[model samples]
Target: MSSPEPRAPRYLVRRWGQLLLGLLLYGIAISLMIRADIGLDPWTVFAQGVARQSGWSIGIVTIVVGAIVLLLWIPLKQRPGIGTVLNVLLVGLALDLGLAFVRTPEELWARILLFAGGLALLALATGLYLGARFGPGPRDGLMTGAHARFGWAIWKVRTGVEVTVLAIGWMLGGTVGVGTVAFALLIGPMVHWTVPRLRVPAAGDPPRPARRRSARAQAAPA
Candidate 1:
């Protein structure tokens, strides 16, 4: 008999802790974006624009958009894991709370620096949070679900979604400035570089059953 494949770890407290840290990092990132006076991420841009248009708080717009995204998960049969749900909720809450105290930068150079710094911080947070392997954010989960359903490349699907969000956000009055363009170009590379370094060893788990394969087929393949 063959040995089982290794399963991913499932430490609830540890995962939650990672998520909390990610959330804090995310907050800092958003604060930097605001300070930059540049555009926010596509999702945040949409939320901020909607908040401005509808006279709703940015947090409220975030919740609404998150709920809408969460609904998309149901049809895909993707359950909302803890990290996923928290991501939807905590990001908005953090933005609101952080903005309460943090002031936007007054100078153009300061704004530019803050924007770049924000992107880096956001990338770091994403790496740490995803490293926990708990679950993906709504947007990421949506991309994953689409990839599974349509056999599309994850990057293509993700890019299309972000483009759509950016368009809508721009139409609704979100700041789509140099920073937005910079982030669009830089975020993926930053996340790729940071995630492996940030990933901790998968702890407290045993192996799972490996899928059975035919020996002749394996031999034939290479």
Candidate 2:
């Protein structure tokens, strides 16, 4: 007689949970930064620019942007996992929900606090999702795909892409301010610190190679 069906591995379930939670938190963090209205990271600036021009909400723009980026993955021979797909769908919805509930503050101190909280939350979320190892987000996948396709250094690819987007975003009237500088300065180190600590261990996991983001600014997945 056939035995009862085997259950899914607990770690698989845990990984899925972590991915979802991380994406949700990432969206909320983005919303917080937007409400702070001081500045935003590069991709968010791009989203804001598109949102401004298209008259769509930033969350909607985010989803559209993610989908578009995913399409670009095809030519680069990038394959996506369920985590990547969900990252595209879920983060934007969460961002909109978060924006609905969170309000902007009038005081400079309060705005600074909000941006700081958002940045911290964003860093934590990046660790959780990436540590799950389901897949890279669309933006990150693009950078890696370009590196592999062209044999460019990861840092060079990242810088070129971000600078291009930053230029377009600025031209499209997205906010560019101190927060943008702060994000560029801080996110790499923060992600480097958090990812190692938060990464989940699996039975057959391979040893990850050491990366030197300190020497080169390695932006986390947007």
Candidate 3:
């Protein structure tokens, strides 16, 4: 089913505001996961690893990494939208900002809670930004673009990329722990549950058709 149409002025306010808020939450989530010290997602793990080796902040590494990934999209003929650009800029900045205030807790249970909460927030952030319909993030675009260009299954593309990153990041001294396991298990379902409800209509997005008919009906002259 199509989303309800949201009108201008108010639409712009809600759209951009939600996008920014989502990005902010996403960055904070990344920071929380890092502070949790249990594990990190593959992309962040790669960033953390590179940061450790390069003596840069993880957030800086994240931005640099995103830009590089976006560049890869060009060869695949992917065009980035405003959301994509903001994803590159704001997420890393927010992460750094979050880190300035967030601390790693010593207790295991607290760390676990923080890690779980971070995952939940990340899922919601994803839905919010995506629902705004500005565009997909660099990483997501890379996957989708690859799928479009090479005709590889989405799962194949995503898995290969993530595994490669995870291996490289782990080799580079990024921490991988129970949190990683938790993320892998919970993220898909959590995002699935949240996205449909949380999504807002994107500007200029087409509405979904109400229903489908049989082949004969579909093939009939308009």
Candidate 4:
């Protein structure tokens, strides 16, 4: 027997809830980064460094980075959707808010634990948010755009971007340490695991037409 079609309402509601929860988890992940005090994520590190050097708010720095990344999407023919815009704004705001209240851990072990846990949660949140299928994050969209335009492998493109950003941020006095390395290594797996678990509408659900019965063949068999 064929399986019944999945309900749209069930999928939509679950996706929406996951999106909200994902954002919150992202916020907590940033908070954990702040508390860890080892280092920020490469992108966040860049934003923080720019903020420090330019005397701009971290949020403003983030907006600028995201805007620049978004502009790259034009040549690649990737339109900015609601989720994309939200990701650009929300991530900065969430980071700023998280930093405001999250105090740095005093002990080394505490910091290390926070860094590992935070990195995992951040990856998980990214996957959950993306599973909504609304759009990709600005940085992610930028990487994808570059991959399409330059014909570079995604891993190579991503590694180059991360390395360049991390080096610049470090030169500008952003923290670069064990946490940065940990994030780079572990985030991919965490996202791969979490995204599949969040409920989203299946793209392969469209119905296929039933095959016509061959009357001659059927009569011979009977």
Residues 88-112, model 2: lDDT tens digits: 9999999999999999999989999
**lDDT over C-alpha atoms for residue 65 of model 2:** 95
Model 1 regions lying over 4 Å from their true place: 1-14, 203-222
For model 4, state the Cα shift of residue 88 in Å: 0.7
Candidate 1 local lDDT, 1-222, one digit each (tens): 444433535555566677789977886688679667877778778777788899987876887798799899877777877778888888878777777876877888878887888888899999878876768888888989888877899989888888888888889888888777788788889999977766555544444458788888788856
Residues 11-33 of candidate 3 have per-residue lDDT tens digits of: 78888987899888999999999
The reply for model 4, stretches above 4 Å from the true place, is 1-10, 203-222
lDDT of 4 by residue, 107-195 (tens): 99988988888888888888778887768888888788888888888889888998899889888877877787777777778888887
Write down the RMSD of all candidates, one decimal each. 9.1, 9.7, 8.1, 8.7
Residue 167 CA displacement from its true place in model 2, Å: 1.3
Report the error of model 3 at residue 180, Å: 0.7
Give the lDDT of residue 166 in candidate 2. 86
lDDT of 3 at 194: 72
Cα deviation at 85, candidate 3, in Å, is 0.7
Q: Taking the candidates one at a time, how many backbone clashes does each contain?
A: 0, 0, 0, 0
Model 2 ranges off by over 4 Å = 1-9, 205-222
Worst 10 residues of 2 by lDDT: 213-222
Minimum summed lDDT over a 10-residue window in model 4 is located at 199-208
TM-score of each: 0.82, 0.87, 0.88, 0.82
Give me the displacement of residue 102 in model 2, in angstroms: 0.9
Q: Give candidate 2's whole-model lDDT.
A: 0.91
